[model samples]
Target chain A: MMAVTGQFMILYVIAHVLGNYTIFAGAINAYAEGLRHWPYTIILWSSRTLLLISVFLHTWYGIILKLENRKAKPETYALTRYRSASLAGRTMVWSGLLIALFLIFHLLHFTFQVIEPGIAATAHPDALGRPDVLTMVVGSFQRAGIAALYVVGVLGLGLHLYHGIESSIQTEGLNNDRTLPVVVRTGMAISVVLFLMYAAIPVSILMGILK
Target chain B: MNLTLYVWRQEDRNDKGRLVQYEARDISRDVSFLEMLDIVNEGLVKKGDDPISFDSDCREGICGMCGQVVNGVAHGPRKKTTVCQLHMRHFKDGDTLYIEPFRARAFPVIKDLIVDRTAMEKIIESGGYISVHTGGVPDGNAVLIAKRDADAAMDAAECIGCGACIAACPNGSAMLFTAAKVSHLAMLPQGRIEAGSRVCVMTEEMLKQGFGNCSNHYECEAVCPKGIKVRFIAKLYREFIKAKGNL
Candidate 1:
């Protein structure tokens, strides 16, 4: 359950990041406007519903599995030396929890506009009579603290994905001896790329490259 | 080599175990780990004190009768080696070793440094075998299995059911052991007949034995004496998915 839902969220993240790149081309407002209006809204809402369900199921099953894992090993070793398990692989629960918190804060700050209502794009329309998403996003990322927070969040995301992607593949039985090394390396590479792409937005805005 | 050992001493299954420190003096570097323990046991016997009890039989790695967590790494720090086969040369003089039994809820402590691994036996009993009609001994070349398949099956078959994989896993998952059993048989023509049902039944039994789910830590592979790969677990999942689809 965790693997399937996590893969679904990964697909959504890929699309979401690609859409986010529109901000660089100054088409974010129109993009955001198109997303909320007319037939596109149907797709938007369906995706949102699916994402919500996926997050819920992922968190729920992740918690249950973690708890069972804890119970299975009631006692810990006095001294442990990990030979193959990576640091990220060992700290999945911690990184997952951080991502959950970051997701909530991100939704409140941007999607719901509950954290900073004054800069909400929904209230201030662009010259083309569309939601000023670009203004809202730029204004938010311009802050050093928020940008740093976003960087940290994306770092957590990268760490989570570093282990999660290949784990899901293995769990789904899509990996084999011949493909294991490739799968692991590809998972790490994709995670690093996604991190750079996502972190680049806030970093560029904070550096005054995107206004 | 002299060493400081903190060995777990448990009276019985219900006793709360504690680490009791002992000084192992003048131990030869060539002696096996279990032999060093035997030396310590000899001292205890001379002193009329209760000797530290640990499990060992063949003193060789094949029997799978001896196991313990030495310095937290299952079967000690030597890679692909069981405790019985682990020599004292791996340790330095004055090295402090923390020895503990294989700890998992399913494998309760029977005594000092000994855990009851009958849970693994139960998993094996579920579906780790294939049945055949009673008849004359079949010809060896009758089943024309591919070389790759035979080699893979042999690799999986190297598992001695030592339970080190479980001890090494953070979640105490028996997926490696169970996967080895499933993969070896599933790769063979005779065992492929019931591969689907075999995987389903064995997995169910594994879960019921209080073993944890695989989280892909790959620690099991690292500590496996026979060097069983985690790919078998993936194959187990594949067989399981195929079984579910057939259902």
Candidate 2:
């Protein structure tokens, strides 16, 4: 699942980067404006639907692993009076879940606004009456605090991915001399690349490079 | 520091068991948990009292021979370590330690701090082996199992048949023990021929021994000294489902 999600996140980033390149065509804002007219764009609809499914599956398996871990070490982590273990391993669930929460908020802030540009909080019925993905992305990253939060979330994803890939192979009984090393290294590389790429996207936008 | 022991003593399999308190003097902090018990037994022996009988051998951690309900834990205080590996220092000086044999309908207490772990032996005997003939050794290269397959098998083979999984489990299930052994064999081509009967017979033997069903709680994985995971049981379920034609 570490590999699966790491690969998925990388895929999402690549799609984001490639999709962002659409602005290079002509009048990027016009493309954003044209995007609002289509009731159900093919790339928009299918990709969004697949993204939702993958997120669900990722969570579904992540929860299974967590529950299993809890069952095995009921008192080890939770009930131990000594609270000096590494905070990284201790709050693994919350850290991973924070990443999930960030992804949802990200989709809402960037993608939700594009669907129904006019929908207001209570004034609009659809509740998704918003547009301006660029502004939302720029505005969200422009905030120093929000940028820090995103940075932490990406780091959480990295830490979570680090342990998750190795654990998943061991759990799935897919460990081997040849493939285990390959899988671990690839998972590590993908995790690092995705974190850097995602970090750069926000930092670049904040620096007005996406201008 | 010496301690007071409240041990659960049962005369025989048919007899009722109850808590019997005895004071142990001058316990060494460096001694293993069982070594402390040995000191208590020596104290009883000096008075011509019946020494508390517990299961143990190869006092080193590997044999998985020593197990007890020490202070309500299946093993003692340390996580992932076995009873024999636990030392006296973890407890406070002069603390009253409660020692009890692991109890369940599946594991009937035979004496103080000792139960009939033969339930495990029986499960292994039922279907834990491959049907190979004893003769000239076959070349290892003859069987070209993938490196991955061999590694997985080795991991599953690490199960030491310690009943800690049963003791730690809320349901007293031995599914983990049986599954680990089964998985070790089932992963190889030599074992695949008997996989159908092996799972059926061993699972039946586990049930017959009055061991509880695995509900996937995974306490087995946590307390397992060998770290034999709960995933092996999931693998068992998958294989059984496949063999039963349910999948």
Candidate 3:
């Protein structure tokens, strides 16, 4: 169930991020503007909310299982020497904490408050007169610190992504040798793109290419 | 091949241990594991430093005295080989080996890689014997055991009481070792009469020793020097369950 919820979480995050990608063609302001007055904005926000809940539940299971294993088997092995168990078993708690922190900071930066006041982020119409996202992203990344922070945050997201993404697929029972490597690689590729694309906006602004 | 040994150096059981790296140069690959350690100790002695502390008497695998966590692996990665029988060729030249003691909660570090394995002796003392009167040494054919039963019993009896089972088991349960001893005697016709009582007392003693419970991880079976099967545990469990009902 933890694995299933984790997979569900990845799916939701991917969809949300892809939706956020509309800013690539337009601008950050255009994406926020899209959120403000759009056909699917309500559903977009609702799915993200559900994704947050799934992440919380999955992390909770990881913590509970670690605690149980610690009590049942405190030592790594019979010998006092060092040993490596599963990567997920060792780092799930730390990774889950980082993801939780990133979510809060992310909401504060974009959803609740426009941390940069003077950045022109008005919800304007785009190609189809749907609120454009391109301008909002460009305007937000214009601030050097904000862009750097976003890059670093996404890097943390990347760390969580690589481990969580593959394990989630395995947990969901599609764990055959033939398909497992493919799913793992695909999950990694998706996360790397998410991080790179999200970071590119800030880097572009830093390079004086935007706002 | 020559290797650097990052041996755990502790003066006593209560000492705060640290890695004291030593150059165990010119050691032979064909040398038995303890013999290589003996050469290192000889080097330490010549330099007037304290020799690296480890255990071995028979220098043969039968003593069950030598074992350490070499490079994060118990008994140095040899399948079913005791530390005494393990040769140095398995290690690569110029390897930095991390040596430490077997680390179960019940097995406290005495000094260096040696642990206080007296807990194993206690489990055996609980009921690893028959209470039958010994007037004269009974004839070997008195029990008239079949060959298969006798062979299996001997295989189970081959457990050297090394506590390797305890070290390898993730939970540190001595069930394999305890069960081996139990199965050894219980399979015999003369020993079957007291099988129920023998298993119960030993199991209770195992718990009293503060070892963790078994979780069926099978690492114990993987590292056991005697190659004892987990089936002995099943046999012990059967006798235990029956004993509980009788209680």
Candidate 4:
């Protein structure tokens, strides 16, 4: 269940990154406005609902898997050693929790306007007379502290996605000798690229490349 | 070669094990790891001290009877080698080794360096076989099998059931072991008749035996003495999903 939900979230995350690119082109306000009007609104709300279901299922299954893993080894090894499990694989729970926290923070900061109130929160209008989401993103990223948090959050996301994608493929029975290495490498490359793209927004703002 | 051994000692299933240090003096580098232990046991016998007890039968890697965590690595540091085949030459002079039974909730320590692996047997008993009539033996060529399928089946059949995968797994999962059994059978025509029901029953038995689910760490493959691959796990999943869908 976690693997299936994780695959769904991967698609959502890629779409989210593409949507965020609207900010770079200074059309974030228009994009936000576009999402709220016409047939797009139904599609938008449906995707949101689907994402919520995936998050809930993914997290609940993750906790259950963790408990099951713990029950298998009631006694701890005095000196444990890892041979093939990677650092990302070992720290999956930590990275997952970090991404969850980031998701909550992200929703509050951008969607609800309950945190990191900025120009967008004040209902400032862009040239197209829509809420200035581009300014809001810029103003938030301008601060070194907020930008650093974004960097950390994306890195955690990268770590989570790296293992999650590979594991999901295997769990879904797509892993074979011929395709296993390719799946692993492709998952890792996509994770790194996604992290870099998300990190670019905050980094570009902090570097004064964007206003 | 002289070496120091910190062997885990437990009187019974309920007894708490502790590391007891023993001096292994005048050990030969040419001897297998089990033979090194034999030298130490001889001294203990002559002194009327309780000899350290460990499991061994074939004194070869083929028998899954001998296994212990040597310096935190299952079946010692060498890849694809069991403790029975692990020679003393792999260790340096004056080296210290930490030897302990395979640790898992399902595999309890029966005595010093010996764990109860019958939990694995219980899982196998659950559904690891096919029912056949007590008739004359069928010809070997009766059931024609493709070369690819036979090769894949043999690859998974290499699992030695050493429980090293469980000891090495962070989750202590028996997925690799169970998967090997399931996949090796599922690929063949004879075993394919009951593959669906067999996988379901065996997997349920594994979970009931207190084994954890595989989290795709691939640690089992790295530590397996028989060099079993983790891809069998994927095949197990396919078999399971197919079975459930049919149900």
Candidate 5:
């Protein structure tokens, strides 16, 4: 169930990244406003519902697995050494928690518009009379600290997604010796591409490249 | 090979254990690791000191009896080698070794370096067998298996039921061992009749034994004496998902 929900979230992230690139085309505000229309609104809200359920299920299963793992080893070794386990694999819980916190912060900043003043109240309309989401994103990332925070968040997301995707494929039994290298490469590709794209938004804003 | 050994000593399961240093002087370099311990045990016996107790039947690596975490690596520093098969020649003279039993909640210390590995047996007993009639042996060609599956099953079957997978796993997961047992049976046509129930029961028993879940760290595969691949674990998950639908 955890893997299944994780795959769902991966799909959502891919869709989110593709849609979010509209910012570069100067269509982000129009895209954002268009999502609120009738048919698009239905699709948007349904996906939101699915994502919400996936997050909840993923978290719930993660906690259960963590507790079970803890109970399995009541006593730890006095002196320990890792052979094949990566640092990212070992720090999964920490990365997962960081990602969760970032998600909450992201929703507050964008969906609830609670982080910045006048974000929710003021109507910054574009030439097409659409709510100007591009300006809000640009203004948020223009702040050095916010840009740094976004960079850290993207790094965490990349690490989490890398391990999460590989693990999910393993859990789903989609890998064998012949295909494991491909699976690993695919995971690395997805995480790296997503991280670069997501990090570019804030980086371009902070560098004064995207107005 | 004058080796310094830091051996774990515990009277019983309830007793607290600590590492006791022992000096084995003037040992032959060609002797196996277990033989060196035997020499040390002889000296202790002559002095009326209690000899350390450990589990080992076959001095060969195939039996899966002898194992110890030498220098924090399960089955010693040599890759894919059991403790009994490890020779003192691998170590330099005056080298210090930290010897401890396989540590896990499912594997408790019975005495000195000996741990109770009955948990593994219980998992096997749960569903590691095929239900066949009590009669004459079936013909050799009765069931013709595909070469790929036969080889895959053979790879998984190479697991020697040793608890090294548990000791090596940071999470203490026995997924490799359990998966090997399940996959070995699941791949064969003779065992596929009860594959669903076998996987379900065996996995349940594994969890009940307090073993952790696999996180795909591949630690178990790294320290496995038989070089069992983690791919069996993936097959186990596939079998598990299919089994759950049946259940």
Candidate 6:
């Protein structure tokens, strides 16, 4: 259940990052306007619903698995040593919790526009009578603290995906001995590319390159 | 070589275990790890003290009868080596060793360095077999299996059921052992008839045994004495999902 939901969320994140590229193309305001309008609005709302469900299930099962795994090992060794487990593999629960926390803050800051009402896009319309999403996003990223917080959140997502993608592949039995190494490398490559793509937005805006 | 050993000592299942220090003085480096313990046991016997109890049958690596965590690594620091086959030469002179029994909820400590592994037997009994008629002996050439499939089956069949993988896993999952059993059979034509039910039944039994789910840490593969790969686990999932789809 966790793997399925996690992979679904990863798909959503990929689409989200691709959509976010509209800002660089200078069509972010029009794109946001199109999403809020009819027809496209249906896709927007339905995708949001699916993503919300995926997040809830992913976090719920992650916690249950963590608790069950802990219970399975009641007595720990006096000197524990990991042979092949990676640092990211060991701290999955921590990274997952970080992502969950960031999601909440993200929704409040951007989607709901309740966190910073002064820069809320809903209150400021562009010249085309659309929500000034581009300005609002650029304005927010211009702040050093918010940009740093976004960097942290993106890092958490990267670390989570680094382990999560290959884990899901293994869980779903999509890999064999010959393909396992390739799958692992592919997963890492995807994670690094996604991280660079997502983090580049805030970083570019902060450097006054996207404005 | 002389070494200090901090061995876990427990009277019974109810007793809270504690690490008791023992000096293994002037021990020969050529002896197996179990033999070194035997020398310590002999000294305790002479002094009228309760000797440490551990499980071992063949003392050979294939029996899977002996398993203990040496310095926190299951089956010791050597790769793909069981405790019984582990030699004293691996450790340097004057080194301190911490030896503990396999620690998992399913394999509780019955005494010092001996955990009850009946849980694993229960898993095997559930569905780790194939049905064969008791009539005339069948010819070996009756089954003409692909060379690739036969080798893969042999790879998975190498698992010794030592419980070392469970001991090493942070989740204490039995997926590696169960997967090995399932994969070895699923690769054979005879075992394919009951593959669907076998995977489901064994998975159910594993969960019922209080074993945790696999988190893909690959620690089980790392500590496995048989060099069983995690690919067998992936095969187990493949067989399981295919079975579920059919159902």
Per-candidate local distance difference test: 0.93, 0.69, 0.72, 0.90, 0.88, 0.92
Candidate 5 pairs with clashing backbones = none
Deviation of model 3 at B154, angstroms: 0.9
lDDT of 5 by residue, A32-132 (tens): 88789998999899989999999999989898988888888777665677888877778878888998999998888877778985654236666677777
Clashes (backbone N, CA, C under 3 Å), per candidate, total 0, 4, 23, 0, 0, 0
TM-score of 2: 0.57
Candidate 5 lDDT, tens digit per residue, B8-98?
Answer: 9999999999999999999998998999999999999999999989889988999999888888888988888999999989999999988
Please write out the lDDT profile of model 3 over residues B90-186, one tens digit for every residue.
8889988888777777788899889899888888889999888645767878758899789879989999887777776656678789888998999
Q: List, residue by residue over A1-211, the lDDT tens digit for candidate 4.
A: 9888899889989999999898788777778888989888998898899999999999888989989999998876656788988889878888999999998988888898767654554467777677878778888889899899889999999999888789999998889888888998899999999999999999999999988
Worst 10 residues of 1 chain A by lDDT: A110-119
> Which candidate would rank higher by DockQ, 2 or 4?
4
Backbone clashes in model 1, listed as residue pairs: none
Report the CAPRI category for model 6. high
Tens digits of per-residue lDDT for model 1, B1-247: 8999999999998899899999999999999999999999999999999999888998879989899999889999999999999999999999999999998888999999888999999998999998755367668887688999999999999999999999989998999999999999999878998899999999999999999989998999999988999999999999999999999
> Which one is best on DockQ?
1
Tell me which of candidates 3 and 5 scores higher on TM-score: 5
For residues B192-244, could you state the per-residue lDDT of candidate 4 as single tens digits? 98999999999999999999989998989999999898889999999999999
| lDDT of model 5 at position A19 | 88
- Model 2 Cα lDDT, one tens digit per residue, B1-247: 8788888888888887778999878888898898988888898898999999998998777888889877766776678778998898887788987787775567777887788888899999999998766357778798789998898889889877779888766557788898888888889988977887788899889878777655433556767778786667757765665677732
Write down the TM-score for model 1: 0.97
Clashing pairs in 2: A113-A130, A116-A130, A117-A130, A119-A129
Report the lDDT of model 6 for residue A130.
89
Docking class of 5: medium
DockQ of each: 0.88, 0.03, 0.09, 0.79, 0.73, 0.85
Clashing pairs in 4: none
Interface RMSD of 6: 0.7
Q: What is the DockQ of candidate 4?
A: 0.79
Worst 10 residues of 2 chain A by lDDT: A76-85
